[model samples]
Target chain A: MAEPSWSNALEALADNKFVLGDQLVDVGISAPELASALAAVAMAQGELGHARHLYHWSHELQGISKEIRAESGKALSVLRHHENWIELMVSLLAVNVAARVLLERLRQLNEAMVVSKTAKMLVEMAEHITFAGEWCRRFRAETGAIPGLFQAALSRQSDAICAWLRAVDAEIGGGSDMDMANAFVREMEMVCGPVTVRHPA
Target chain B: MSTSVEYRAYAVFARSQRGGPLYQIGFVEAFSDALAKTYANLTYDEENWFELCVVPLDELRWVIEPQGVSAKGESGRGGAIVEQRAGSAG
Candidate 1:
């Protein structure tokens, strides 16, 4: 496949953010506590704001109109294919953590616009990662079934996650696919410990 | 099954700028001091604070009479005494 331009990558990132934010807003209605629900709402608003920023940046950088850019449906299908809240949380935790790492590296780019935008996004993403980590920890402590649920979610979505990483790598030329996957898994383990899942033979 | 965890209440204070007075912004509940700080930071970071801190609600000592209330005022202080309880505040 031909490598995607920086503009295309930004578009994809924006779509992913929108999808993630939308899902969070939907799931937040059922949050166990008012505090957790409010946190989810805050995170959803932040992610949506980031998406708008990226979309506007892409439009300006590539001379694409906002209307045209908005019509582009490049969101990840994996996010739409979740089975449960636990699955959604696991997938979001993994994807957002990995995206944070990639965005950090992208901030090293010499382009002033890219550096500034990436820095702003990184600060917000740090809070997202922290919130996700804390939620995962709470799930583990309260549910007692989070490890198994996470493992099942990971096994089900591994392919999509790997493909997403590959596409991001192709666009940005950062870490290898294996390296990114390992980093994501390590972060997941830190949040929820060793997840064990049985694979179909 | 969802397990219930007792979250300690923390009172948050923030200074809007350098050398400014630290005013009470809000409160948050968490299972630990670290989580309380995180919750406080996440929930009350709308402003550009010069500094922020969180202390357990139980740690604060309430002044019942503000140093110079007469015996008449003391009779009406029952409400303040009840409100000072840790559980009541939380």
Candidate 2:
């Protein structure tokens, strides 16, 4: 990709963080287990923190006090609150994986500040990915021989996830070798199950 | 967590300085080391530690007692040091 101007990409990435953070706490409140709730809250904090940093980096903030950007109109519908625990897990998995794809692309910017911040965020995201994958396996195991519960959820979110990624690729002005949407689907399928991203080659 | 793997207890350790020795701070119960390490950092977030580590409770060799021994008693850990010697004496 011709170096992502990073201006719009940062804005879009920030929006993802805002939506993901909100949905985490919202869905996490109904989490049956205390550990799950706590982990969700922690992840929410991390996402919001990333959103704040991204906004700062892109100079999207109006003033020093107005650091973090609010949720944009463009955030994906799939990122919203879900009805049940499994749905919540799937939503989180999608956002977590897609965001990592974007960040990996962002890492290509290779500037000192961008590289440092993305590196830290990537570290936290590794944990998030681990949590998402573990939850999917756990949820599937709970269904006990009933197949497709995880796949069903992934299928539901796949379209929106692909759209969000396409936007990221476009916003980044990706002329690079890596197709983010395809990369996202590959990583996502590795975590949950097969995902057919119809859009983006 | 109904379908989740059994959660394992992990002993958490951290050091705040560059050369500081890792100190055993506490423990967290988690399904894997990734979660355990995250939980340890999340739970013991008071310090700006330079490093953190989490090891499964089962991995530790029991130099003392292998049985369930409460550390809540007068004994420091395992509650077997003084009591076992007294028991053996009798």
Candidate 3:
């Protein structure tokens, strides 16, 4: 197999961050509570900051202008799968968890450039994961069950999520979709026990 | 659909560089000490801080008034004295 281009990987990561950040800001405006809205805005800003850094680094390495990179198409299907607030929160948690996994994998590659950038991104992601997990746990505690909407959104977005993982895996030359899915499921279970998906038969 | 999670308030302190004194930068809300630390660092990491720490608001005690005042206290300019209290310690 040919070695994956780091520039391509960075560009893809930057695009994902930009799209996710935009969705987060939208969600922030629609969030029901003040605290959640503030947190969503903060997280959205963090995501945009990550995108800016990643894009700048990629441009430094690949000589691509920020405008061109920002204009490039992004794979945002998974983020767009959430239709409601609950679904949006769950989707953010799932996506961030999956992204963290890929980031860790990239960091483990031992490449100086990749490791440094991934490490910084991971620092911001750590707080994001904490916030998301706490919110999910709070939702589960209050409702006593993972809402059907969240479950449905997760099931609907699973394919896109897997595709994202696969793409990252291909870029990093390691990890599998199955492993990433299993890990994500385990994280979801930890946050909200055994999320049930009611599939239409 | 409520997304407000209860979090304890924590006062954040940071040292700008090595051997510098840790001063109050800002505050963050989190459930645990670990989360508080992470939130403090992530939220206020715009500057190159050498170290950061958080203390729960409940952990610190406050002195209501350092200088006692009378109801109709006189000031040097012959005006009523206005008492002011500091914010929470943490």
lDDT of every model, 2 decimals: 0.69, 0.73, 0.66
Cα lDDT of model 3 by residue, A105-164, tens digit = 556667776777677788777777777776665555555345555556656555566566
Cand. 2 Cα-lDDT:
0.73
Candidate 3 lDDT by residue in tens digits, B1-90 = 444546699999889989888899888876667657656765686898888888998887867524345443442331234322222332
Say what the interface RMSD of candidate 3 is: 3.9
Put the candidates in DockQ order, highest first: 2, 1, 3
Q: What's the lDDT for residue A17 in model 1?
A: 80
iRMSD, per candidate, in listed order? 2.7, 2.7, 3.9
Compared with the true structure, what per-residue lDDT tens digits does model 2 show for residues A31-121? 7667778888888898888887777765533333353436766566766657666777787777778778877776676667667767888
TM-score for each predicted model, relative to the true structure: 0.76, 0.78, 0.68
lDDT string, candidate 2, B1-90, tens digits: 454468898998899899879899998888767667777877788989999899998898877664446544543565565587679999
DockQ of each: 0.28, 0.32, 0.17
TM-scores of chain A, one for each prediction: 0.79, 0.83, 0.78
Q: Is candidate 2 or candidate 3 better by DockQ?
A: 2
Q: Which runs of model 3 end up more than 4 angstroms from their true locations?
A: A5-10, A32-35, A53-66, A69-71, A81-85, A144-146, A167-177, A187-201, B1-7, B25-39, B42-46, B61-90
Residue B18's C-alpha lDDT in candidate 1? Answer: 94
DockQ of 1: 0.28
